[model samples]
Target: MRNILVTGGAGFIGSNLVRELQVRHPEARIVVVDDFRSGDFRNLRGFRGDFVTADVSRLDWNAQFRDEIFDAIFHEASITDTTVHDPYLQAHDNIEGFRRLLRFAEPHQTPVVYASSAATYGICSGVQEESQPAAPANIYAFSKVQLDNLARDHARRFPAWRIVGLRYFNVYGPAESHKKAAASMIYQLYLQMKAGRRPRVFRAGEHCRDFVYVKDVVAMTLQALNAPRSDIFNCGSGQAVSFNEVIAILNRHLGTRLEPEYIDNPYAFYQPHTQADMSRARAELGFTPRFTPATGIPDYLGSLSPS
Candidate 1:
């Protein structure tokens, strides 16, 4: 059986990936570890697998994971919430979590496929690629960038192991049922419009992102683990779309003519543009994102309804 260890499996994309892998690979024994922090536990309500609720940093891997060696590690645990005030705490959990996981993986020589961020390419003008030097704007972005750098150097030393750092763009899709503060824009916007409450738009919504679907990201990540060489790849939809276009697509799905209400931008922290150059991912991992907001929002939103 293919033994897969998924960190942060209770979160949005992680939870979805857990479900997908379980269904596809029945013989696989999936171990999910999330501290019940950013990711909701309810996300794994019907999940059938080995559920170990432990902080990724505090995990006793040597004892708990002694009998078995992991085939792959989905390193998704990190500090992503923007409302955080203490930068020190964020670094400890987000940055240090991977540091510990790395130490664990290195000894076992397990292939670790981790979630890197597009935020690593902050304030850049050209298409964001793996070659671009990471310049993080916020503390959260900084932690993710730090993790990517660690992976880069780690892979260089351990050429025999598969260490993939996937720089994920604006990822959004199903299984995100948390509040406004927890879920993505698409999910929150759907809830707003459905409840007859107008969703507010900020800064004329000109900023663009390579909004990749969760399913596509998972597929590419799995492919990365099986790859022969260790590398970092931009896992994102090749097409860039504005935030306004995202809301427009959601409106069509709800069958409502509700237009977005422009509001004064409150959160000053944001990346103006985060488009990706998926050329490397395509060439290396044969990764290509299959979902656009227009085509995907409807179904993804529909799946997250209050049942």
Candidate 2:
């Protein structure tokens, strides 16, 4: 890729991807576009590229781009807050924003690698796969499902366009502190432990999720660029780890014996388990997660300390 545009480049995954792209493709001209709603400027530290401050949902791409052409568009901009109940706002930003990006890519025939969500699969008994029907439980999840369907149609009409949608599970790692409440439990738990308070867990901490590290996610995203055709794939470690195990790992890393405080879950739409079936990603995108909870947690903790 030569000239590239990364929407939401200030966000967690997007910023990480942008950094890697800079290192791997030093000759490419990269531009980052973000409204800075949930994205933090600190995440873009040491970034050397153009940046556009505007909402992708309503930006006039024709006016903005003028004669510039992008080789690829990384569409990561979205309303990712799962607790937001306003349908109009969610649809406007996530669904409509994606449509705008897709339209911008149509004329250039640029490839798109966008972020999808594991929330698309609600209450799945087994590992979540792309073939299964989406059962989104919240507006955020619903927004992703709409985007996935739209991508499918876009691919059907534009047969040669390369579009890859990645359904990411619980992604946690560096540069996610800006996510605030939307940040992963790993950060939240770390904060609790740092304060000398016990890490809180809902129920018996038996709830399981395939929490993939950010580095692995960035690798899978870059690999998706090579996908020959349009398709959606799961981005996760393929191994299910319980909340209790996470706490245990944190305790080991911090050298503490802090016990977790179990509490009741208030949200009715909670998913007790989520495991990604990596068969499709491996066979198609050549994705294989290198970090398990044991390996990833310590690395994340280490990064938090000073050099």
Candidate 3:
């Protein structure tokens, strides 16, 4: 727990997680791994630490770990966009990277805390629980399901290794700079609104997602890392907010703004009415998210302001 490796540490959630960990464990040195493609360098630039700029899925962890031993590894590296699905690349990165990391951790006994997705719960009617079993609808969701299953099987075989995966809900805040439409819509929409454009909404504006704030996500993630429960937990506020509601919240903060423009569901991939059943996370590991979108939006906007 002293020295940690934050894969995709320069990205949205990982960047914030690293910052939180630095303050909580001030003496601890964090090693950040980022390709900085879809992940931005701006997120990592503010943090004080060493970094490795390379594709995580391709890197040989055994050789990488030969120099230093990581007490914990946060495996956040993955291809997230559903619009751009190259099965070969997705499987290799999302699926294979996990196996490689597991193999590396086999000898060192360093526990892994990796990012799973709420996307994996694609098209579910009710709140998704760890025990309910996942039926992902897209390649992105499928990849995480595969990783979770792989981790489970591997854990059974190698009883010594402890692996944790988090099903992160709609994570949003500063430093989320992914430009793709499928990325954090809140941030993208905010920027668009600030520039006198309305935030686009899904066809019905009825699709709901558990929009968990960045800071809460970071705190819960650290707790999971420290607790080492060796289980996959859903990280979210467990409340659903529709896209229409999100635009209304934005308008309220900015003193009346453009009305949301409805559009066709662009991606043929998957969109679900997403909410998390975080009972397991709260009861077992003592994790409770503090920020709701309504309360979080003002601060989020304030932080992003150039003034």
Candidate 4:
């Protein structure tokens, strides 16, 4: 049987990826390693897999698994809160945790597909590309950039091992309620509309993001793991949409014409725009994002309703 390990499997994207992995490889032995720090255990409900309750930063791999080998490793655990100002904590968990995983993978020559972030391109002017210079505006972005740099070094040292990093843009979908304030703006808007309140936005709500759906993110992640090359690629829809457009889409889906309440922007390090250049991902990993807000909001909102 195939063996796989997913860190942060109780978190939003990680849980979704766990579900997809189970479906695609039914006979595979999937082991989830999560500390339950920012993740909700309910996200893993109905999941058939072994759960290892431990922080990635402090995991004792040898003590738990002994000499068991893994076919692939999905490294998703990290300090993802951008508003957090704790650089030391970010470096310890996000950076040091990855270093530990790399050491584990090196001996096994296991393929690793890890989560990077678009935050690395804090204020890029044009389409964000993998080859462009990294400009981190916050500690969270700095952590991801550090991870990517470490991945590059690992790739060079272990030429035969696959170490792919995906610089994910704004990702949204089901199983993200656990994120709360950290959830996608799309989800935040949905909740506001459900409560009969106007969804709030910053200033004119024109700031754009290349919001890629969770399903697409999962698909691309799998592709990255299986790809022949070890490199970092941008994971996004390759199309930028304004926050106002997202609110409009939510309004249309919920059948409520509620206007967005504009407020003063509080984030001094806010990114005004982001659009992924998909050529690299397409050419390298055969990744094509399948969701846009217009096409995806209805299904997403429907999933939120009580069944």
Candidate 5:
């Protein structure tokens, strides 16, 4: 790939993917597009690439880059806050942004890989598979479901085009500090413990999530660019760890005996559990997640520590 486009390149997963692309394809010219709504420039420190500050939903692609041809396009820009209750804003920004991006890429048939979310599985129990019907509990998740629907429709219309969507589970790592409240639970818990306070979690601390490290998510994303066919795949650690287990992992890494302070889960649509069924990803994309909470937490904490 000689030239690539990464939307939301200043965000957590996008920033990590941008860095990896630079290392893997040193000669390629990367162009990043972000509106900075949920993205932080700090994440792109020392990044050597072209950047366009604009909202993907309202971007005039032809006017922005008249004749630039892209080898691949990574669509990561979206309203990621799950607590957002505004249906119109979520649908317009997340879904419309993707629709416009597809229209821009269709001419070149640029292979596009976009971010989807496991939240689309809603309150489903057990492992989440790609084939399962979407049951989005919030506007944010519903937007992602719409994205998948749009991708499917586009694929059917243009069978020769390549478009892959990845349903990410709970991802946590560096560059996500900017997300603040929307950041992963792992990061939030780490911060609480670091401040010499007991980590707070939903009561009983038994709600489980499949916390996959950002590095693994990026790896899976890069692999998706080389998929033989366009399809959605689950990107996660493939293991379900409870909130109490996460607190234990943090305590072990931080060397703190701080116990979790249980609190009521205020959100009425919270997911109780999520685990990814990665058999499809393994067979199709050769994806093998390298980090679970036990290992990922330590590595992430080490990265945050002073050198």
Candidate 6:
């Protein structure tokens, strides 16, 4: 049986990835590591796998799993909140945590597929390609840029090992309610409209983002395990959708015509536009996002309906 380790397996994308892993690799021995800082136990409700609750940055990996050899390590733990301004906290947790994981996996030369955020692009306009230089706008994104740098250096030192980094765009789907404020705009908007309140957005709601579905993100993540070479790829729906379009879609699905309540922009670090350039992902990872807001929103909403 395959042995797999998923850090942050109790969080949004992590939880979805964990459940999907169970269905795809039922016989695999999956061990989840999470600190529950931003992760919630409810996200792992039906998960039937060994779980270790500890901060990956501070955990003593060798002492905890002395003889275990993992077939793959999916490193998803990170300070994902973009609004967080504390440099030391974000850098320590995000960068050092990944560093420790790399050290643990180094001796075994384990194949690692870790999460890299599109936030590294910052306010860069046009299509976001992997080759473009990183322009991190906030401390959270800066930490991810450091992660890619670390991954590159590690891959150089250990050429035989596979270390694939996926730069995920805005992802949303089921099992994300636990994220609350950090959740995707789609989920936040749905909640407002569901409660008969006007959906809120930055003034005019013209900002655009590549809102890829979590299922697609998980699919691409799984595909990275088989990557032939160590590299980074952008994971997002190739198309961009505007915030105004999202409100329209939500209104149509919920059968409510609630107009959006425009508000002043609060965050100076907010990116005005983000659209992934998926040409590389298609050629390399054979990944093409299967859902756009037009289709994904309804599916996500239906899943939230008391089933």
TM-score list, all predictions: 0.94, 0.98, 0.93, 0.97, 0.98, 0.98
lDDT of 4 by residue, 127-216 (tens): 898889898988899889999999999889888889999999999999999888999999998899889999899999999988888989
Q: lDDT, candidate 2, residue 159?
A: 91
Q: Write down the TM-score for model 1.
A: 0.94
Clashing pairs in 4: none
Report the error of model 2 at residue 267, Å.
2.9
Off by over 4 Å in 6: 267-269
C-alpha lDDT of candidate 6 relative to the true structure: 0.93
Write one digit per residue (lDDT tens) for candidate 3, span 74-177. 88888877665777888778898888878877777788888998877777766778887687777888899999998788778777677888899998887786
Kindly report the root-mean-square deviation of model 4 from the true structure over all alpha carbons.
1.2
Q: Write the per-residue lDDT of candidate 6 for residues 49-70, one digit (tens) a residue.
A: 9999999999999999998999
Regarding TM-score, does 1 or 6 come out ahead? 6
Candidate 4, residue 126: how far the Cα is off, in Å: 2.7
Model 1 over residues 1-307: C-alpha lDDT tens digits?
A: 3898999899887888898888888889899988878788888877888988888877787777876788789988776685674899888888888988888889778889899888777766557878888788778888888888888889888888788888888778876665346566766677788888877768688777778888788888878876768888888887788878888887777778777888887665666677889888888777777777776676576676644
TM-score of 3: 0.93
Give the count of colliding residue pairs in each prediction.
0, 0, 0, 0, 0, 0
Model 5 per-residue lDDT tens digits across residues 132-242 = 999987789899999999999998998889899999999999889999999999999999999999999999999999999999999999999888888999999999999
C-alpha displacement of 248 in model 2, angstroms?
0.4
Candidate 2, 1-307: lDDT as tens digits: 8898999999999999999999999989999999999999999998989999999999998899988889888888887777789999987789999998898889977899999999888767568888999998778889999989999999999999998999999999999999999999988998899788999999999999899999999999989989979999999989999999999999998988999999999977567788999999999887799998899989999888644
| Model 5 lDDT on a 0 to 1 scale | 0.93
Please give the distance, in angstroms, between residue 186's alpha carbon in candidate 2 and its true position after superposition: 1.0
Candidates 1 and 3 compared: the better one by TM-score is 1
* Residue 16 accuracy (lDDT) in model 3: 85
Selected candidate, larger TM-score, 2 vs 3 = 2
> lDDT of model 2 at residue 252?
93
Report clash pairs, candidate 3.
none
